[model samples]
Target: MRGDTEWGSIPGLVRYASERYADAEAVVEGRTRITYAELGARVERSTAACMADGVRPGDRVAIWAPNTLDWIVAALGAVSAGAVLVPLNTRFKGAEASDVLRRSGARTLFVTGTFLGTSYVASLRRAMAAGGGLDALRVVVLADDAPADFRTWKDFLAEGEGVGQARVRRRWESVAGEWPSDLVYTSGTTGRPKGAVITHAQTLRAYEVWSDLAGLGTGDRYLIVNPFFHTFGYKAGVIACLTRGATMIPQPVFNVDTVLANLAAERVSVLPGPPTLLQSLLDHPARGAHDLSALRLVVTGAAVVPLRLVERLRDELRVATVLTAYGLSEASGIVTMCRRGDDPAVIAATSGRAIPGTEVRVDAPAPGEPGEVLVRGFNVMRGYWQDAAATAGTLTPDGWLRTGDVGVLDAAGNLRVTDRIKDMFIVGGFNAYPAEIEQLLGLHPDVADVAVVGVPDARLGEVGRAYVVRRAGAPLTGEDLMAWARREMANYKVPRSVEFVAELPRNASGKVVKGGLRGTPATG
Candidate 1:
């Protein structure tokens, strides 16, 4: 394959990979293994299916499924047919997913059947019914048996039967580098999720640099434990694998035993996830029995990495390369990454220097002080999908994106993330904005006021702890609040602990002083 400049569109990249590594294994999931040639063919057929369904250029297509080979094909196929892909978090409850789908105005949805005993299709139906129905959204289920109302995976693929291959080729060729590729929704400080619009060229170029820096190469087996809905798994995991000819092994969920078995069975060479994933593997009793000798590379970040975790990954796991990277959805999921051979202390202390063509600036009050991190680069998102006011608030008129993260830049340009200016805390690797959690907590009848803040944890790097003020005569407990939160939001967003107080500290402006609640005693 040619260098970065050659492939502009994702479909173009897939074509390039097929030609360069025709018979090479491209995807491995359970009993199925697909070659690059077959993968490319399937993507083309999927593109044709989308076209036949009247999916026009710039149309929004949503995928709400777990990590699987079908997810890759559907996403690539949709993008190839000039549709902007919108990935819904598998962890999202029906209402949450509906909000995103409704906001993005997605015209079509591709989902899975029962997984882990949760019927995603049923959840979606309930959400739509509750919201008075989605706007002409088409649903296609990728499983053996879908509801009578929806189309199955095979049926969806058959939509392309009558469409000519030449038509699909024309659609693929029509897509330009600057076209919108994916609309990934991230929760802002305002307590609502906004879609970050990223272009095809930006994504392809960014991950190419990522693949090179990480030393990913042909024939390397990559076990992707990261969820495909996020940029880390889709752009870095799938796109990076395609760009470098590495074989992708998609793990739907993160289980230590499954990961170990896949690593040894596939001779996995590259593995990337949050620190908790690696920690679990290290702590698992059966870890030593698994043939993890083939594990050669590891990439971890998204929370504070204890120096000991880094040391153990190398010393105990015997991995040759371990890298830490930092980026958000607005920046195409990468801003800086530690190089292959950097010192472990450096990897743990800072997220490495900005990638090529990207610049990082700290808006500090004085030298060496932490401030909001500003990023300007090719990887910067176009803007939020349609919310211009929200987009304007994030990106400056000139071009810099206000990351809402408070961090400092070293003399060498490495970024050290210290705190969040937006009060967004990462739980196990997922971002949980405090405003969103507080909004839900305030709805309880017995709660008079609530404030949420993040506290350090030994397992999950940080978990939310809420401080609440009970009504004068109401009998309310911290456990009651916790139970209510679990039903109202995603598991990661639920506060692990709650503290009931008689009153909450506030400033003259009436804003809750989050700092005062940080070290408060927990009632749970």
Candidate 2:
């Protein structure tokens, strides 16, 4: 936290990390462990390759692959060559891929032929052919040798490829003027996802804050199972590892056994996963069989974790520290993180106060209550790419980002999230908090998990409907669940109907897909 310098750009962050930990392992993909020295060389070669193929400053170069070394190379390569990287979600279908590609106007895409059982090249080809300003597509670099309209990684990197420590430093100096490094598309829950234009300065500041707060250093190793498409993966996983000189264990997808095994094998010190992943790790019968003694820090977000679950982690897992982060794509990932030394109540119920440089304030408090969460920080994005109206909606005239979430700050300055402004509904002229209902429903004996949503009603104007996942071997009908809720809550708060499900639909980032569940019947 004491380190001070004027270099606030992402390329600068890469330079600093490379200089500090030149020979240290920067990333590990299965058997391949690439040191910062090697990482710099690869990024340099990859950047030169793109530049040779006519990519210029501000050109959009997309990485349309799953979590792999090639993904990191391409991302860093694009940034180094003064091209803003656009990362497409690997979970996206042809249509979704096409929309993102066309909208971003990416000139080149570094792709992996087949990753996680999906043919990325095939989908990219189809998407490109369907068209919009993608005809200028110059090169496609494949990680593995697959016969196609493209060059292999070895061949591509041969373009003006230079080696040595001196060259890596020189390559970084060439692109230091480029402010914004990546154009990332936020997972649009409503309408087409707009790209949050993140600058190099913004992203570096985010990683700096993260590195300082987590006390990360060259000795640490991070297990990154999150997808590269999300901000958490980029800022928390990629940038955090780079800034701190920590080795990154890249996983293409979340595999419970493999993740646990890697933590032991890699001796991973920093671990970040969604609550769902943590729940599985804790619930696994083989959990005690594995070695997690090396695991020191655990951080989670993307959803409100249950207090009981957090308590179990602290008590049973014997973790040194556990933190819950509150972030958004617009803010370059982390705005606030529950401090490692925070109380269990704050750790369980809130995402804690803003990080050192960020400012968080309530927009409009309801007479003696919480209000909409507003944030202002260097980490905040310049604006949504090419959508002035939507950009205006999020960024206020005073520069504060009006995050759609509602929260309250206690006397200690810990921020407790209450609900989403968009999710809140008026019921009988009174606002109903779906999160409150869902939290209560989650406490039911038969309920494994629950999500509450507002539905249009002829009489009540809008009423609550509950979607639940029953605990294993527990049987609870819709009527039984409704009756149980009625006994525990007031008439207005009790769910009018209940639907049982195996699991809730979630986005790539693991947030519940509430919009997807809107039109379904009361019981499934």
The numbered model that scores best in lDDT is: 1
Q: Please give the CA lDDT of all the candidate structures.
A: 0.91, 0.76
Compared with the true structure, the alpha-carbon lDDT of candidate 1 equals 0.91
Which lDDT tens digits does candidate 1 get at residues 175-253?
A: 8999999999998877988999999999999999998889899989999999999999999999999998899999999
CA lDDT, candidate 1, residue 55: 96
- Given candidate 1, what's the lDDT at residue 236? 90
Model 1 segments beyond 4 Å from truth? 1-4
TM-score of each: 0.97, 0.79
Per-residue lDDT tens digits of candidate 2, residues 391-443?
Answer: 99889998999888888887677777776766865454333567756776777
What is the alpha-carbon lDDT of model 2 when measured against the actual structure?
A: 0.76
Clashing pairs in model 2, backbone N/Cα/C closer than 3 A: 180-199
